[model samples]
Target chain A: MQRNSKLSEMAEVKLLGVLPSPYVYRVIWALKLKGIPYEFVKENLSNKSPLLLKCNPVHKKIPVLVHGEKSVCESMIIVEYINEVWPQNPLLPNDLHERAVTRFWSKFADDKGSSVLKIFRTREDEMEQVKKEILEMLQAIEDHGLGDKKFFGGDQIGIADIAFGSVIHWLTVMEEGILGAKLLEAHKFPRLYSWLKNFQQAPVIKENLPDFEEAVAFYKGLREASLGRAASK
Target chain B: MQRNSKLSEMAEVKLLGVLPSPYVYRVIWALKLKGIPYEFVKENLSNKSPLLLKCNPVHKKIPVLVHGEKSVCESMIIVEYINEVWPQNPLLPNDLHERAVTRFWSKFADDKGSSVLKIFRTREDEMEQVKKEILEMLQAIEDHGLGDKKFFGGDQIGIADIAFGSVIHWLTVMEEGILGAKLLEAHKFPRLYSWLKNFQQAPVIKENLPDFEEAVAFYKGLREASLGRAASK
Candidate 1:
């Protein structure tokens, strides 16, 4: 896609990220939803760019969004920044209570949602514990995080949806490919199951996800390498 | 302070928390700074109040804020809710990029600041790692976070300050009283040391801090009980 000169005029927006990262996709989806034009730089995980290091010195992780000269690191923080900067199609709800609730879930995504990533690095006994935590995480969101709301922040695709959407989808892809078991089963989580349907079908998110097979293969290779390192240790 | 029904009409604000809790203090400082009136319900951490469990069923932790009928959990989140609900005295900076920067440091408090708490729980050998992390956390803020600016967000006291403040003070109280060491020395962290002085001198913060000697004694007793429990286990 050609750069929209009009959009770029406000500020130079750039994203530093690696492929097959739901965190990176969170930023991509938020930008696309808000209709903000940004250049995407694919970062090599092994050899991080000097710009990435300078932008996010504390964590040294991404996706870091450089808006003009200021850079915002962490996935959801970048989403919130995008929402605030480009307030056209509001990603967070307007109501103060709803905004706080959206942020609560967004924080939940970071605190609890990252537990699923342990599958990549855990031993057999630890993977069982990780899987249990994942189930409890899914159950909590299913029971308390969603109702018949269609999306987490109600009818609109809000920030919380963007936060958890990446986790739910990619978790499923990894579970299906590696474990050969359904972590997000319909019977286990009917509410979350339906939420998954409504969330992905949204035009913005639907178009932005990495290809299913490619992502699975990528995660498989990454997981094998991770476990292999664990074994060597 | 007595509850004013008139103030409650605008929003019936109630805080659920136990005394001597730094997490609880973050919300208290923000509310007091904003000059919002509210009733405080002291919770028993050993046996939590039903209201505490109900408002924050997910985390089941204290420092949950109830405004009218709505509730917000997580200390920083509650501070944010207080900022939004009562925007008279803003805790966050107004500039879009500055707000992102404020949130980045606030998140850093949770991600990095909590490592300092290990002194309360860990054995002597573990203290080295904990102190190393705390030093790095302080250095990150000194070397990169603060500059000639008085506060993390600039001249005025901001959200990031409040977030990091609770962690620093609590760690100091526990460290000084329990460990018998000064974790935040002026010679080591000149910028942060000046920040602590400026932060504590601010009327709202100065007035709200727990009685220092009393708090130290309380932490000393708690530490002995905690460490004794660990020994038995």
Candidate 2:
């Protein structure tokens, strides 16, 4: 077992992820935050790479982090591995309860925040339902997730912040695809909106974000294709 | 907060979960294994109770575990919370690497195991696709998840075991709901099938599982309702 300092230098870390997925971006941000150099292999979700299939055959999904030969799947689990492998900038809190709370919000973001995508492919009535869900999610996060703290886990940015940071930022860009604006409006969720701004300004996040124009264009194409399929049906 | 001993005695740890959901059963098995006394509040998912809504407004879903004023949502998160609040029979390994592996499989089970549900709801062609996914997931677990180890982590049943145990067991019942029998053929996935048998016999799991007849009847009702909805559409 390698210690933290040695693992950083010795481990050949590689990330297999797509370009635009917020889940993949969480791993990228964490690796960059820890100053761990890694080779990035972009995967086509339509035709996943053999390495991804081998590493995570259960899910056969991206954001699979390979350190040396050991592969870790699931976005947040990869982030947690990165935290343990290279403990320079800690991603989790020291207190057990605080850590649990951070994990609670992080898991919440991963599970519930997928509704943003649902808003994109859905029709008007379904989109309204998705909008209500987004508001309730944002409200829960605003009430239980953040207080006066700059990040989800006190002063420094941690895993929970990384989880939610990617979510709000990407969802904001996907707003054009939603067809109706409701939850992310500044008045309704002012603190989260401000947090979004603050989060994007962070150095690692700002440097690593996907090109905004391209992401919007991609989502637009996806929405069109989905609607086309529905119409044909 | 409260110390572990005090929590075990005074607090009532009630699990709010639906019968058909494997995710809910993960928490149930964990609580039972720990020898913690608790109440089970069975939820009618179609008409959610005020308590379920109040406890988990964010997702408004099971399985929510309520301990005093605190409520934890999401299945695996609730299991982890149970592990923390009751430290006697540890579900997760103490070693960092082993913990990461346990988490890796737990996440795998949560994300990939849903393919079984897809088979239950979809038409023949879509069911074939979902069956392919289910086979791949089962094979991966057989090859990578369990080797010489009796359980996922080691000799003792751990978090990964609890997570996948419910899925694999419930998948058998769900198979009766589906049109085909492709997931766990005795010839194809012998190791996984054997593991399933071993998992069922484990004392904690065997005692706490829902009655087999009831589960089959419940799934049959769900299957009929889903088919009816599809035909109506």
Best candidate, lDDT-wise?
Answer: 1
lDDT per residue for candidate 1 within B112-213, as digits (tens), equals: 988866677777877888888888999999888888889998888889999999988887787778778887889989999999888999999999998888
A1-233: candidate 1 lDDT, tens digit per residue: 33323333388899999887989999999999988888999999789999999999988997999877678898988888888878788887777777888888889988988886767667677677888889999988987898778988889898899989888888888787677788899998999999999988888888988899998888788788988987898
Q: Tell me the tens digit of each residue's lDDT in model 2 across A1-233.
A: 44343333466888998888888999999999999888999888888888988888766888898877677888888888788778898998875556777888988888888887775588765776877787788998877678777888987889998999877877877775445344577787777877787788888889988888888888888888888899899
> Candidate 1: what is its chain A TM-score?
0.94
Residue pairs of candidate 1 with colliding backbone atoms:
none
Against the reference, the lDDT scores of all candidates come to 0.86, 0.81
Q: Point out where model 1 deviates above 4 Å.
A: A1-9, B1-9
Q: Point out the worst 10-residue segment of candidate 1 chain A by lDDT.
A: A1-10
Quality class of the docking in candidate 2, CAPRI style: acceptable
Q: Which pairs of residues have clashing backbones in candidate 2? A: none
**Which portions of model 2 miss their true places by more than 4 Å?**
A1-10, A17-21, A35-54, A57-61, A87-89, A94-98, A114-149, A175-183, A210-233, B1-10, B18-21, B42-48, B117-133, B176-182, B224-233
